[model samples]
Target chain A: MPDSFDNVSVSTKANVYFDGKVVSHSLILADGRKKSLGVIFPGEYHFGTADPEVMEITAGACEVVIDGTTETRAVAAGSSFTVAANSGFTIRVTDSPCEYICSFGTP
Target chain B: MPDSFDNVSVSTKANVYFDGKVVSHSLILADGRKKSLGVIFPGEYHFGTADPEVMEITAGACEVVIDGTTETRAVAAGSSFTVAANSGFTIRVTDSPCEYICSFGTP
Candidate 1:
């Protein structure tokens, strides 16, 4: 399973498989046309603080708390959604880390 | 950071962030039209055992050992390639776990 990529330097990223824990990482968002995205399972947050348009493709069912309001959204597998930039949200997993993919536009 | 998805049951998957270590997971391949894929960083393998046509999008440049032969291919960021099924390969990381995405078609 040891595979390495060339040219593109490996960056430091963290995935904390736990509840009530916060983890943060710095990402250089892609250009509007380039997709800069990654996956986050249940019990994790994928935050892109510098970009204005952030999108998440929910890979499982989960609850999202956006800007102080909590709502239950059933993000079907393979579906995608957008979260406005600077909109800090908390996602509490009802199952586990819900599998989801997210992308952000570079400044 | 905890979020859960509906309908889609959370499945058990293993990811070993190491070199020369082998990890395996069972996946239900999607239909040809439905894109079933996920990301794997450097020093890891994403193997789709059942399907005949498996595709991988290299998120970073890496070397891939197909079947029993070894070759170094620079898979530029955002480029995609297909691995014919049953063509088992071992990828040795020269950088780290190369970032890549892979999908498989259902039988």
Candidate 2:
């Protein structure tokens, strides 16, 4: 995974969610792919996706339960998870904040 | 004034502050200037700076009192506040979250 993205366009304003418990900055890559860099505080959050998405954890850890699944996977740093289009997942972060890069559109 | 920045490098990880009350993503401009896109939850935060900074509000609002100053300026969207080097400022956000683009190094 890349530590930083070069030759991209990023929004000045942030996408704030759950009263700032989660915040992200949107950016478009040179190839026109949209992604978001975000931080999730220690809490449980459920997010629905309009398109298939890949979430890569960059820092800290989280527990994820994908929709229609009973398994709760413990995801650590440098790990990733995929969610189906139009589906959702519940993520819980403990100990500290979890940072991630969410790639939208396709898994 | 620009909603988005073109041709830049952005970090995948975010800077979390005040136990996630404030979150920011760092990026570098084409000219090598450093900036951060951030959101501030409804709270008061005091930050010390090594370099002078210009904080431009992109969404919502905040009240700021620069270090050693008594005036509390109400800054809204499209407004900005400058902090001197080796100094700091106390920012308060009430009612709603505040979004800002913080430019570092110079005013």
For every prediction, compared with the true complex, DockQ reads 0.03, 0.91
| Candidate 1 regions with alpha-carbon error over 4 angstroms | A1-39, A42-64, A69-86, A100-107, B1-37, B46-58, B70-74, B78-82, B92-107
**Which window of ten consecutive residues has the lowest lDDT sum in model 1 chain B?**
B1-10
Q: Per-residue lDDT for B8-106 in model 2, tens only? A: 999888888888888888999999999999998899999998989999999999999999999999999999999999999999999688989999996
Candidate 1: lDDT of A8?
Answer: 18
lDDT of 2: 0.92
Q: How large is the interface RMSD of each prediction?
A: 15.8, 0.7
Residue pairs with clashing backbones, model 2: none
Worst lDDT window (10 residues) for model 2 chain B?
B13-22
Candidate 2 local Cα displacement, residue B6, angstroms: 1.0
lDDT tens digits by residue: candidate 1, B4-31: 1112111222232332132222223122
Query: Across residues A9-101, which tens digit of lDDT does each residue of candidate 2 receive?
Result: 998878888877788899999999999999888889999988899999999999999999999999999999999999999999987889999
